[model samples]
Target: MTDIFNKIETSFRASLRGEESTDKLIYVWGIISYVLAFLLNKLIKTVHVYFFGTTISAVLICYFAWHIYALKKCSPKKPKLTKEEKQKLREEKRKEFGKKLMRKLLLQESFTKWDPIFISIVIDAFCIAQFIDYIIR
Candidate 1:
């Protein structure tokens, strides 16, 4: 039990530092958080409870924003490559891009962090919008 908590805390701290969460834990966390948010919306039937949705939205927005910032900041600066190396790199990139495009269009697989983060942002925005709608009603 203690080990589990410690590992979770460590992963959280690593993510806060802009590093990826330990292995598969982040996917688990995101799924659990989404389910929890959905349950909260369903079980809590009052307008005041909308605040919970808004709060979750804000937290998620901040987290992904910081995560993106950290990822960009921590990315390695590429050293200048020889022309041949540059050509090889460009060729590799093109191949990778083609693979990704095919995977996205055919297999519906998203391997990049940005895709999930973008989806989360859209959902969070919807949560916020729902909260505002409730308040307005």
Candidate 2:
């Protein structure tokens, strides 16, 4: 209804401003994209193979450009570190990586970040749709 649409619009605006988590939006979009792709394919009676490819490429380019822009705009300059300090930092990162890997393996960690999940959902939907179409034909 109006309430649902208002929430979606708010979320979309917030996401555009990098002020909101996009997990729900990405999930909803993934489902809608897949459904629409199927319906469009059926209605048109022909697949536009380049359409999705071009769309994905353009999205990726824009995403990377925006990411670079954000990083350049918001990131602090790195401090110059002494050799010993650099080594210590690297050792700490190594230990942290090891612990993180172990935690992930044991399922003690949960990912709340949305980007990887969003990308996987998109790729999976595309692949699954292509597979289903292949089977139907």
Candidate 3:
């Protein structure tokens, strides 16, 4: 049991660092946001509460949007290469298939850090719109 817990903790940390797959974290955060919105609708039963929640959710959406924009801005762009250089690179990659595969996997893992933030933004925007409509009515 302790070993399982330790493994889980390690994996969670790795995911936080964008070194492991984050699909599950993304899904869990998305579901939790939706559930919170649903519960707020059912339990709050007040326009003021909904308005407050919507405001907070909108703020979160903005924050996540800014984060994504920053990430995109900070990402390094690929350098331009001539046709012959491209062909040479492709041939080298073909010769080193294992290294190419590893690099591809690493690049995929690195980008996964944004998945949860994107999911959160979408979920928060939806929830904000939902509660705003509820409040308006």
- Most accurate candidate by TM-score: 1
List all candidate RMSDs to the true structure.
Answer: 6.1, 8.4, 10.6
Clashing pairs in 3: none
| lDDT, candidates in the order shown | 0.59, 0.55, 0.57
Instruction: Order the candidates by lDDT, highest first.
Output: 1, 3, 2
TM-score of each: 0.46, 0.40, 0.40
Superposed Cα deviation of residue 2, candidate 3 (Å): 44
Candidate 1 TM-score over all chains jointly: 0.46
How should the candidates be ordered by TM-score, best one leading?
1, 3, 2
Q: Tell me the tens digit of each residue's lDDT in model 1 across 24-60.
A: 3335555565566566556545545666656655665
Please identify model 1 stretches exceeding 4 Å from their true place.
21-26, 46-114, 131-137
What is the lDDT, from 0 to 100, of the residue 95 in candidate 2? 82
Q: Which stretches of candidate 3 lie over 4 Å from their true place?
A: 1-48, 98-137
Residue-level lDDT tens digits of model 3 in 54-88: 66555545544543343333333569999999999
For TM-score, candidate 1 versus 2, the one ahead is 1
